[model samples]
Target: MAKETLLTYLDEQIEKKLADFDVAIDWDTRNHTIEVIVRLYAENTNHMAIDDREGVRSEEEIIEFEDAILLYDDQKAVFDEDDYLAVIPFAGKKGMQQKVIDALIMYLPEILVKGQDDLLDFLVSDEESIFELHFSPDYFQALQADMTTAKQERFLPYPSY
Candidate 1:
């Protein structure tokens, strides 16, 4: 199918089920193949309250917004000289990489994106099949190595819901 056809199909599908997610994808036509820029907005949960005789502010801290650049069947010049994708500005903090990947894998079944099944298989294992996603980055190898050491040396158990 032509790229335009595919793009239209995806847009319609996402629009139909827009309530499922809080993110959106924008297509870039200037490139040759099907390329898209993904963006996710950070949630704001700010509120003010009066305590005794004073006012206090409480809100969820904004860690960072989730974002990525994707290419379908094409790997053009998306990366810069520093190995960061020009389109995807935020690579996220090192500690939060796994969490971000997990979110991506958990939402892999969405029909709007291509290669859903393949990404599902790679990102998730049987036990964590429900909430795991893999990030395909040039530095993934080194990160994984460090992650393994961290997991082994400083791992702690937490109750799983």
Candidate 2:
């Protein structure tokens, strides 16, 4: 199949995975080689929106939401303009955690490419495609919301870790 078709296939598969959330695939239009990841996020930015004036922020609200963030627009006195996605304290709700896990599970049995020499090489190699989009595709990677815990664990092998 064509690459565009495959990307569409990726979207189509993710679209059908759940009923409550949206999965957006941000393709690396610049690199176009060995750069592919599917990112699924909940529409929490709007839900987590506080008023134009500063309002109370819950500890849970501060932790669970991590997509777009409230930017301190100097021109205005409020922090409603969110152009950042920062990683602060990351302890989320059980349901939010489960949704993230479900999305990962929905795509775990597949890869974007095949013929990986090893885990490290597979992680580093540039990509072209040759695998089942639903099964184990040849070259691809995936990301979802709330992977901070997983990311922290993955870096535990480093000296600085």
TM-score versus the correct structure, for each prediction? 0.32, 0.25
lDDT of 2 by residue, 1-161 (tens): 53223234344555665333432444332322111232222222223332221345432222122122111212322222232221111121111132233334354333222211222232233462221123222221234443456532321110010
lDDT of model number 2 = 0.28
- The runs of at least 3 residues in candidate 1 whose Cα sits more than 4 Å from the true structure, single-residue gaps closed, are 1-4, 33-60, 72-161
Report the poorest 10 consecutive residues by lDDT, candidate 1. Answer: 86-95
Q: Candidate 2: which pairs clash?
A: 34-127, 112-138, 112-139, 112-140, 113-138, 113-139, 113-140, 114-138, 131-137, 131-138
- Per-candidate clashes, comma-separated: 0, 10
Residue 33, candidate 2: Cα error in Å is 5.9
Give candidate 2 misplaced runs (Cα > 4 Å): 1-4, 33-105, 108-161
Positional deviation of 124 in candidate 2, in angstroms?
A: 36
Model 1: per-residue lDDT, tens digit, 55-150?
A: 233243331223343432134324333321222222211112332222233343342243344333323333432222234454433444544433
